[model samples]
Target: MSISPLKETIPKLDPPNNTSLHPPPSPSTHRTLRRLKSAHVLGSSVSQPSLISQQHKQSLNRNFSPTRKVTNPPPGAHTRTRSNSDANVMSPALSSPISRRPQMKRASPVEGSTLDRLIRDGPTEGDLERGLESMRLKILDQGVKSDGDGMSSLRIYVWLVLLNAPVLETDEYLSLIHRGASPAYSKIRNDTFRTLATDPLFRRRVSEASLIRLLNAVAWKLHDAKGERSEVQMRLTNTANIYGSPELQHATPAKGRSRATTLTNDGSDAGKSEPGTYVQGMNVLAAPFLYAARSEAEAFIAFHQFITTECPGYVRGAMDGVHKGLALVDKVLAIVDPKLSLYLIGKGMNAELYAFPSVLTLCACTPPLPEVLRLWDFLFAYGAHLNILCIVAQLVILRNSILNSPSPTKILRSFPPLQADIVKEVTLTLVKKIPDDIYAEIVIHAK
Candidate 1:
């Protein structure tokens, strides 16, 4: 009954079944098996036909081909063959020697098309209400949208509605123009010629005279508001002192004039101007209105409402809101991209140092006016103050180059022209990260 050593060493098979007792090999393990099999076949003097199929031999050679490294299959796949088209379709991240960081994609054009539906056909009252609701929801859900055509009627109409701009009386605007320019007329004139100087869209479409008129109209509006406020103050002041005070009672003509001047508080003789007077960047703000509107009066109305109501602080004597905006830009950038924020701060490049024009002009400071309009659409839809976040978004977009540069402060001096859609996408994302209290400041800072 004793078996020989060779016979006893033989392994027994399981009872007949469709499947093997062992688990199937994974792609990686299968690949390893193929490598071992290929090496044994190449080294062996005796050819084993079953172990070295012609197809498997070709696959082994393909893996070592000089042209490209063969891609591995997923964990449990059975096949290793990939066609030339599939190889070509492989992501550059996989195919290239150096992988690129993925860029923030501009929000899709479909989102824009949804907003464009507002103006695709002029909506009636019902249509307009529904369109507006749809636009507002989409903006809050995503962000407002626009395309490359900066002067689309859709854009202008959307802005007018978003701004809640009234149907201005032609007479009112004409009267402002007829009254002649404000004392800032010379300053407005100086800035108008160079506004959008190189932008072919602006240059060919809007004349210098038209730009000057719109700016002067805004200046006049500012003057009128100042005068109204001054008149109201004069009415509120006590006049009893003028009648009863000894200084006024004993006044010579000179004393009377000086006393009267002191009482009025106008200070016109000293040449002091009011706050919110025309500033240089106002010209750039007016550029978008003029470019988008069908008429100068229309531009005048939108520009007037925009500055006076939306961002009076930006144009006021100190541009205090703009300064605040710059500070907020720094704070926001820090929250989102701390490395870039700290690097800029270390380089003496806070927002004040670089973002003034952007804050003042609503990013119309940088060109391709179409992009500015696109940005404004978002600003108008959500809040103009979100621009602080938008500026931060621009800094974030440039984060990599900025961090890597030797002199980031100098590099930021003239930031690139806006890719507004991408900026809006990033900005909307950043808005959620901002603390509510700081977000409130962003809203009021521009008021």
Candidate 2:
């Protein structure tokens, strides 16, 4: 079957008539709302409620109130009390002042209709999940709008809701930072300087020192979790040895054997190498969170939640998840656009060679930081697994250029500046062409 080009114009829905609850939209804001109405997001018509009840709006307001107090610090730590207002206040040890960092602008309720109200007034408790789904739909329909400085006033909060990441206390994050450098601190230092080094926007917004702290904090969390898991595994193995038959006892590996190297069905030597607390390309993954977040703690919360939950396999021992994702990219391409797949394979241009960074960093490796943020809005909302399909979408976009080139590797060497809308549209189209079984694999490949 052949794929057809998508229409440039997407149909728009009428804005809800409720003007009393939400502030009226300015001319520019009206244009943005109209664009949002266009079903270009997710490529389907979503019927939104015409009006949110007053009580629901109140519930949303109460949910995000800035009056909450900070959690108590662990014993032997600081005893001073703090509030949500202090969320942005960072410890001197955890951060260094960047001369060029721009002042963050908070999203205003009067900015736009849906997102503004959601940001100003959070979703109701009973409708929390549904509200998040609504936010996702809005984000898909209308991306998180950022300023010229490459900052989105509300993108971080939207991501927090979509990822189901709870509000981490400032003290908790500081406590992690106070632990000093992690075991992987030196390795993290080596990678942080090189992260997004060439992107001016990234350099202007995020600093290497901030990146180091966020990554090292995450390393400490992962290290501690690994220790706990090893302890549990040791106990289980001991229990088995004490109760099991002689053959079972003999089959159990020695206690010091590295569990990180255990083999899987794939032929990769995941079992041969020892896994470390930190891995390469993580700096790229953490860059966006730092860029979007208002404070380091907020960034840490979102970034830590993302790695630990969304794509743990990508950062785990041998990074088997990334390999699996890379393999799926090849399989997905073959299935969706066999002609292009055959052409690339004919030239020996498998995704493993070209798409590794995209898979490992969720396309953060691709340039135009703004577009990367837009793409992530979609990924965080729906599922990160669809990122595999998004990579295929990029290939499909470059189908002709790659097909006609004698040296396709040159064209595939680096992806063109991210065109988030086109890629998302193509990705949604390709999603239909994928078979259920393969699609199922895509969904869980990251986990």
Candidate 3:
């Protein structure tokens, strides 16, 4: 049971010579040696596959994980240390190359949008007559809304286009204003103070000084035209007297009066004024233009064009067109709503007695500036003369109330805030119902 001493055994070997017995391996021998080394390596890997697999997996994770890097990083990039578990459970989004950004807004549709059509067609594109007519149809069909400030800008542009007001250079407008106050300055000043006093839209948007300046400029323009026309007529007459020719006499007669006889683009005479004066209620007619227009000059141009071309008679001698419009209101009412018309007539409530303000101001006498804006869109699109029928339509709508009210005149005096769309519908129907003769008169009444 006693332990014996362990003996160390060493393998005996012969002493080696300095020179190699085997010469350097040939190329084939070298290839075989490489294959044997590869096989030895393969055998070693196969024998220890689990250890190799773990190292391979670690190498893959170190290469793929954003949290680890072997080389210098780019400027502004921070070095962050992440736990092994976090690196293993990294989010794909964090590894993405591109950063996230806000999505862009898609544009709204334009097919049925009136504003889009107006912008697309513009004032100068397409055939003048056809474009205007098509635009009118679009306006009536779609009903333009003042889409806030953008719509306000659109309103002025559309009004200018509808009125056929030419755009003048800023210097020209400035020179016009430089001429100082017109002969009607006193009246313009008085009216400017009172213009749209009740309407918050006008009061908030327009200044009285602006109104005065614009009105005075327009008055001066009208005054200058009248004076020039008179001088021309006098020269023509003098020439005719000196020549004593019958042909000259006929020509002199041709220059008798230059009042516009019709409400069309071809205004009869843009120079001479029959009344030869700017009168009251013009401030109201000019209110919408000033309210919608971006500047005083724009308002002036549109208002001037409106009065001189579209409805000259409204501001001319005795405002004959306004009187005519009032009469037409009664006639139209009598035709469309005889029961209401006769009822009003029975109460001594003719248009002259009640609708003077409505006719005079082109129905701008009504309140709620937004509603007035809508009404004006129709008036500007169609003939302003249609306003008579619009008045009649109002009467028809309130027929039952007028018939039942003890004081119909008071009720009719200041029409309720206009429902432009409803009035448009009623007037359109009245167009078909009225007699041909009455319709013809309606067409020419505002001339």
Each model's lDDT: 0.60, 0.64, 0.58
User: What is candidate 1's local distance difference test score?
Assistant: 0.60
- 32 in model 3: Cα distance from truth in Å? 97
**Arrange candidates by TM-score, highest first: which order?**
2, 3, 1
Give every collision pair in model 2: 60-122, 261-271
For model 1, the superposed segments whose C-alpha errors exceed 4 Å read 1-131, 138-148, 239-274
Q: What is candidate 3's local distance difference test score?
A: 0.58
CA RMSD for every model? 29.8, 15.0, 37.9
- TM-scores, all candidates, are 0.65, 0.71, 0.67
Model 1 root-mean-square deviation: 29.8
Which segments of candidate 2 are over 4 A away from where they belong?
1-113, 241-276
Better of 1 and 2 by lDDT: 2
**lDDT, candidate 1, residue 437?**
72
Which structure is stronger by TM-score: 1 or 3?
Answer: 3
